[model samples]
Target: MLHATGSKKELTRLAYYALVSDILEHADVQALKQFRHHRYTTRFQHSLNVSYYNYLLCRFFHWDAVSAARAGLLHDLYFYETNAYDRTESPGQKSHSAHHPEVAVQNAVDRFALNPLERDMIEKHMWPVTHRMPQYKESYAITFVDKYAAIVEFFGLGAQRMLSHIRRKQTV
Candidate 1:
């Protein structure tokens, strides 16, 4: 429902909502809210942040906005504590950044019917870090948006909104 740190937008009212509303309500996606991420943001919010901003960027460029939005939301689909990983990726084992895109793609394919672009976006969002080349322009949008989401969240820009969201959830 929001994007970036210290920024709030009317998400459901925007065209962006219609593109992602289908999967956003799913239990798997909602489950992201339970995992802490970016210190102050939940994975759900982080993904939403990426999704909305990516959609806007792609839309502005007259690219495939739908795929960009959908992929952004599904990009970080894996659910695990981010810091719970071996610092070094062993010969056979992958570091979390290198491994999660694969995990997320597997999880996404199992739950949703993905087009090739969506699949590419979800799988290659990590880009040079994952050493995976993106197959489409929209794929590159996700990589930027994902990083933007992380930087904003890491700096605690969205903490006030998240706190209010938590307070409202508690009241309900």
Candidate 2:
């Protein structure tokens, strides 16, 4: 587990904040267009949503914020668009639900000179419940945060639909 030890916590937090700020400042407008809801959400929005949820999770766990933030930001880099995972998935691929973590790891490797910890977190983000279980604390943190974000996004959409149905019933 990447326990928050000594000054590492402060250093990592600074780095995490800086990275997130940098990413957001340089965020592509086209990428923002990709952000959408489950019913009508875009991939960019989903990534941002994951990021926000990951931030919350990091605070909860007192983790290395830099690792968690990076993992959250890049977790869905492969999706390109919303529902892309579902549209062209192979039947034999274990879980369409959890395929993005490894892809995200690859993206990180290609895009950044990540340390072993960062790479491990991205690669192992979908463990236990995934094809393979997470091996470290940072990895487990990513996995938990990813799952947490997805669940919130899922239920958030479902709740919106449920409320819409209720409103329709009242109108009828």
Candidate 3:
């Protein structure tokens, strides 16, 4: 069942799906399924969690929830395996945190015509860790949502795995 962090609602059945259905259908977004995030979750799932919670938060605040959701979905949209690159502190060489957003923005722009708010949110979701401050309110919303979703995806999925293992053992 597809659900977001801290919520049990099935995402597709909810109103939130309307905002991201096209982006979700794209080949580039689907490619995230191959990348692991936070150890226990796929980048696709992590992105979905970020997207959903971001949408909810932005909607509550009366911000641009559509942009928030789209940006969240595309924020980490890079292809390389997570640990494959040797991230370095060398000047002019980008760390993984600094680099992936640019790649994601480029990839997203190629497939979707993003507004400035969406662009800012995707580019600055890493916030102070990245070079610029997020210019849009929705952008700031995503930074928190991204981190929140990661923690939940990491520990929540780990717990789920443990429960599943226990269930299997009990069945035996």
Of the two candidates 1 and 3, the one with more favorable lDDT, higher being better, is 3
Candidate 3, which ten residues in sequence have the lowest lDDT sum?
Answer: 82-91
Alpha-carbon TM-score of each model against the true structure = 0.85, 0.69, 0.89
Tens digit of per-residue lDDT, candidate 1, span 1-172 = 4444445777888777887888898999999998888777788988888888888899999999998888888998987888775455568887788889999999999999999999999999998888979989999889988988898787665666778889999999
What is each predicted model's overall lDDT from 0 to 1?
0.85, 0.60, 0.88
Q: Least lDDT summed over 10 consecutive residues: which range in candidate 2?
A: 1-10
Model 3 lDDT per residue over 91-140, tens place: 77888887788888998898899999999998998877897998888888
Instruction: Give stretches of model 1 more than 4 Å off.
Output: 1-6, 87-91, 156-172
* Residues 1-172 of candidate 2: C-alpha lDDT, one tens digit per residue: 1112111243235444576655544444225545454554555555555555566567677876666666666666563653565677777874645666767678656765676767777677767645676666777777776666566556766677789999999999
Candidate 3 wrongly placed segments (more than 4 Å): 87-92, 159-172
- TM-score result, candidate 2: 0.69
Report each candidate's C-alpha RMSD, comma-separated, in the order given: 5.6, 7.3, 2.6
In model 2, how large is the Cα lDDT of residue 18? 70
Instruction: Give the top-scoring candidate (lDDT).
Output: 3
